[model samples]
Target: MEDIRIRYYSKTGNTKKIAEYIANELNLKALSIDQNDYNSPCGLLFLGGAPYANIMSSKLREYANNLIKENVKAVALFTTSNWSRRTVRALKKILREKNILVYDEFLYVHMLAVNGAIEKTKLFVKNILEKYKG
Candidate 1:
């Protein structure tokens, strides 16, 4: 089996936590999007970023635009947000345009500009992992 690679760009660490969980559960390497080179062998690529001001981090978007993957089977997206679909939709569009097969997408409620919901976010992440693991 080709190695799974999980990469993420996070501002407040929420998306990073989710990425770490997915990587650890899949026994794949977890790396910051900026720190890793995309030329490496990757069977499945999981991308994550935190939603900021109703948008995904610019850094993450730029990285995604630059990534060139051949035959990516499954792509997973995760984001931490208060309440905004714009970022997720934008990301989905970008991935689709790239012809990357997105296996699943997830959003975790965050405590930015609102009450912190760390526990809820954790449960959501766990559920996502469990569902995708099947």
Candidate 2:
């Protein structure tokens, strides 16, 4: 309900589902990174993506690099992966370069094939509210 924006680069729909779950639960629209819908000043930006073969995608990096601290106060990173948390670290690094505040708490639900993604996202969103009342 805050001026939060959700953007994700999901190649296999796994990360997209995570974004959708969070958006639906939080009443925000989940947008693909290419949508380029980030315009207004944002209190928090929820950027989602998954590592591709253990590395972060170029497209995700490009978008993150362009994030301005003047527009985004903070970022909440999320990713869907089977054996990696690399995406979170990679995004964090990009955000730091721009001097954007990255939340100490992040969301990393296991790949959707394991089920309970909606439940997991619900809990994640609940924690976000507790930490960031923005």
RMSD of each: 3.9, 1.7
- Alpha carbon lDDT of each predicted model: 0.66, 0.85
- How well is each residue in 1-134 modelled by candidate 2, as lDDT tens digits? 66888899999888898898889988999999997655568887889999988987888888888788899877889998997999999889889987899987888888855257777778888887766785
- Cα lDDT tens digits, model 1, 40-114, are 656667777766777777788887776664745556676666666566677778878888766554655453622
TM-scores of all candidate predictions against the true structure? 0.73, 0.91
Instruction: Please report how far candidate 2 places residue 72 from its true position, in Å.
Output: 0.4
Candidate 2: 10-residue stretch with minimal lDDT: 112-121
Which model scores highest in lDDT?
Answer: 2
* Predicted model with the maximum TM-score: 2
